[model samples]
Target: MRLETEMNMLQAKIQAGIVKDETVGNTSRFSDANPNLPHFQDDLDIWLTRSERFAESKNWSRDKWSSSLSALLTGRALDCYGRLSSEQAQDYDKVKQALMKRYD
Candidate 1:
């Protein structure tokens, strides 16, 4: 009975995205600095919204929506980085690298 209980608990944790061997230490640093980091669904929503807005405003065909959204997001990212202070941007890059390494 005790063994069965432990197995059920382990399965529940794995289903909840908490794999025991996934990380050596806390993985909160990535989420801490960039609280708005895009998850899978968030990315999809961002692209969809951008495409919808572009098509509505410019009367663009559905086929052009993807290209328009890609350009807009790229421009927006560049603009945001351009507005950041050099030191702050560098620090952001370092944090980003650390986060990537954590996943790797």
Candidate 2:
């Protein structure tokens, strides 16, 4: 229930174009420790939303972000596409677009 509320609040801030990344807190590690299970679009949306906020603090290059994000995924879920190759990962925008296309 708490997580749902947080996500909803974050989504509202995003829709409002606040750009205040401060509101989007990373309560979950969202790394190897926190693996998001992808099944329905709702689940995917949560993960993607988290990913977008997580991407903000990242100063690394796009490839690095992609690889970093890849490391956070698990293959058990049908929508989970394992780790992404550096080349396949490309830039954050491309990767995000692809993910949004698939899971949004």
Give me the candidate number with maximum TM-score: 2
- Candidate 1 structure lDDT: 0.36
To one decimal, what is the Cα RMSD in angstroms of model 1 from the true structure? 18.2
In model 2, which range of ten residues has the least summed lDDT?
75-84
Mark the regions of model 2 whose C-alpha exceeds 4 Å error after superposition: 1-42, 76-86
Per-residue CA lDDT of model 2 for 25-69, tens digit only, reads 544343332223232234656776776555555443444455445
Best by lDDT: 2
Regions of model 1 farther than 4 Å from truth: 1-47, 74-104
Per-model C-alpha lDDT, please? 0.36, 0.44
